[model samples]
Target: MELEYDTRYPSVDDLRERARRRIPRFAFEYLDGGCNEDVNLHRNTADIRDVELIPQYLAEHRGSDMRTKLFGHTYSAPFGIAPVGLQGLMWPKSPEILARAAFKHNVPFVLSTVSTASIETISEITEGQAWFQLYHPAEESVRDDIIRRAEAAGCPVLVILCDVPTFGYRPRDIRNGLAMPPKMSVQNILQICGKPNWAIHTLLHGQPNFETLRPYMPAGLNLKQLGAFMNKTFSGRLNEERIKPIRDMWPGKLVLKGVASEADADRAIRLGLDGIIVSNHGGRQLDAGQSAIKPLASIAESFGDQITVMMDSGLRSGPDIARTMACGAKFTFMGRAFMYGTAALGNRGGDHTIAILKLQLQQVMEQICCERTEDFPAFLVRSEITGSAGSTMSNR
Candidate 1:
């Protein structure tokens, strides 16, 4: 909430080379490709930058806060904004400019049910504190009218995803035809006429559809009949009889986003779920798996106290969210680092990528005198080059 960004793009690889020179190489390779041959997306950020953090130079210090909390709500930080599916084709209104920068930085901003804004316009731009993934609908009355429009848009949390189940052999989204009713080709309209400010802000924000499945589509279906109505209306696999009826019809916070295993974090804690993100989809669904920090360190060391074990694939910074919260991930999410900061600073890319990840995680919690954010697991670094046991390192 104290933003002034554009310090020459202070990293996320300089906002991914200024969002690959301001979009349109098939929308920056569909927000930077990942399936097959990406090899678990470059080993999910090279195994989370091979986790390392240790800095108690004469311990005893209390000077870093970064709030956090989760599930019961506190979040000034602990990473968020990991739901990306055609976010205004990468920039135009980029999901209401990252749901108004995740409601002016309180945090959390999930939103993608094939997003392009909707669900009462990002719950009135995060007034309802955005969070709602759910790509399930093979029709249970369109998944109970999208969980009654995310409980009448006061959505607290509801994720759901469960890895793409299929559709990730992404050869740059199949040579940029970008699947599902998306073959605009003529060399993709000459690479969108060479990105004239991303083709004039996608012609004043018009073509990015799927606005929460436009009340179950079918109005003027072109583009291969809207990709055959999104492959005959969704269903990407999730068991326990489709998650015990969305855990008995969603009451509130219930995550479960593509968990990588510990037997699906013991089946999202025997189908009752409250959390479990350990994603693989960021590797764009499989591509010979492994590297979501090796199934988030054995599913946060075997179900991190049974659930709430959050994570996302290859996080990009803030010390890779403090090495995935010192390797246990109580919370973390990052769909292409705030979409490479709104495709490189259009509408100040979500408060300049959440203020350069809260000033590089408060300078690594004040150079590891580590005062909070759960004491970053006492600055981990336990030896034999991080073979677990609370690992961290950086005193070179």
Candidate 2:
């Protein structure tokens, strides 16, 4: 893929700043804020940055390739667009934009159960190649139907969330009325008036709703009723009992997102999961929990042999993706980064964000003398390595 992006916004940080200016205050905070204190949110990126890579200028290196194989697909890069809820709130038709970009790039795009786009729509856009992440519904019937829909849509991977036993306590969202029982206050309306571009786009797309859940939801429910229906419908926590049935019936790659401990990783292996994504729900849940990178090193070292170990949360750029893979993640994903891209540049956002990341990562590989995405661990600084690869580096 050609490395082309709006040079005005060359970096993810630039996209984030532009997005902050473009989107409404309430929506931006919903996409950007974390749980109480946001300690873990900040900690996650801080820890990942602490990892350093060593370049070998003298080593013989042909060229760097970012292609990686996971579950049965060899994606264009080691990263994919992560699943994010309420995507349309941040930018109109964001799920579709990202899905199309990802498909064109030959990378994975995961659709969230609560995202604005429905399974069938995204499936049609991606030609049924996108993955689907489910929010464990309280009703067994609802869960079964959603799973069936995903299967019928030809989603290759089914990601079930294990975190978010309860929604995080986000002060900004609460103050902005983005918390449960979502509302459109006069203040929000005034803010929407300020961003005419976002306002017009949202109007054209129609107000965002749980489109995937439309078939199941009762007709004619307002915001308050929608919030109530969401709270009453999802269970949010996963145990063996909840997962065993899904594993039995999915008949495709089953992944557990939000894994943060070695014990949990081991449990996932025993439960016959195909992969585990080490995440803290993007620090949107468990502000007090350890940063995702910390558990990622331990879990990947201990259990990488048994199952596919991937990660998300706190990753922002291509260098961050390299750092995460060097630390032992087989694959990486990001949610806010792509959203920021869309919010900043509208329709061009998804393609631009992917382009930026690919170019950045390719540069890192060339600089480090690494030849392949899987070879990143070999370039990890000795002091920074924390896994079995680190323990056995003397042999290399």
Candidate 3:
């Protein structure tokens, strides 16, 4: 983690800007764009911003701790990197880079089923700090094989993505022809021409193929063909029956991701799963879905003890992370933020992003007179347009 460069941009947007400049346009849009009208996507961040924290002053300034325990394992931070699909398309060997950084920081790193790197590779790099996120395939044998691979790789946590039964309707991808393997259209070729460094890296890396899927794929498939195959292969929908086998087989923690409604939470609790990530797939899956932070309070109130309620989407900075925690989120995860960091700084991205979040969270704790993770929810305040606010000393 080198902070030698001027830390002018503390926000995720700052890193995004750098990332936009560093990578090609098509790749950047994959990380930046959302489904259909993108209303839910914009709302994810805007809703978090509306939250106000009441600052407490004149408290004895002392040491602050960000360490949090989840499912018996203690992590250095209360946040982790959310799994993102086709990460190598954004930056070469992205999962590996993020996994290594998370391992070094003593935090959790999630590996998506469709990400560029294989589970075994990430497991080796992260030394088993990695958790696997599955997009359930229709084939039971294939799904079971993947589960076995994850277990063999020493992944303690298994995250089954319940949303995304169908792929999000991302208009930017359609326009850019940014499908699975990615087509070299005239426009894409022109875009890559402008990004000389990215082009050179791509040339050297041989265009970021899905290493995990190669063995399972048929012979002589191009990028577009691979994309179509993946689209056809996955079942997308996850239900009680699909989850039962996973719960039975996975000896370690079993997490259900993309959970929104109370019904889903109740079902997850009944399934005897270890935890459920309260997310809307980063507002990418359903266009009309509720903001992740909004329903969290009620969900936590309803099923907090039965299952650990974690959240992702709408989290950019440390304050946003703290805001989610205040609203009963046991843990927070950010996908695009770290991607922006890696895209902006290449190999140095994860370290810098983690550093920035740590700094921001510490400042929030200092102002709120809060020290440990458990004291966070007490500072939570519910409001209308402003959403939630942290209670200041005066309110206390």
| Model 1 steric clash total | 6
lDDT of 1 by residue, 1-396 (tens): 565778888888899888988888888888888877888888889878877877777856758887889889998889888889988887888878888987898889898888888889889988898989988878899988898899899998888887876667788877888876678889988877888888897888778887988988979988898888898899888777888888898889888888777887897898888888888878877778788876676677777887788888888889888878887787888988888888888888988998888899889888877767866865777533235755333331
Weakest 10 consecutive residues of candidate 2 by summed lDDT? 387-396
Quick one: best lDDT, which candidate?
Answer: 2
Local accuracy of candidate 2 as per-residue lDDT tens digits, 229-296: 99999999889999999999999999999999999999999999999999999999898898898888
* Top TM-score model: 2
Candidate ranking under TM-score, highest first, comes to: 2, 3, 1
Q: How many residue pairs clash (N, CA or C atoms closer than 3 angstroms) in each of the candidate models, in the order given?
A: 6, 0, 1
What's the C-alpha lDDT at position 69 in model 2? 99
| Candidate lDDT (C-alpha), each | 0.82, 0.92, 0.84
Candidate 1 to truth, TM: 0.35
Residue ranges of candidate 2 with Cα displaced over 4 Å:
383-396
Tens digits of per-residue lDDT, candidate 3, 1-396, equal: 343323866778899999999898999998898889999998888887776655456666565788999988898889999999889888887788899989988889999988889998999998776999988888887888888998999999999998888878888888888755456689888888999988887787676766666667798887778777887678889999889988998898999999888999999988989999989988888888888877887788789887899999989999998888887888999999999988888788888888888878978887787788766876776666324444444444
Pairs that clash in candidate 3: 181-223
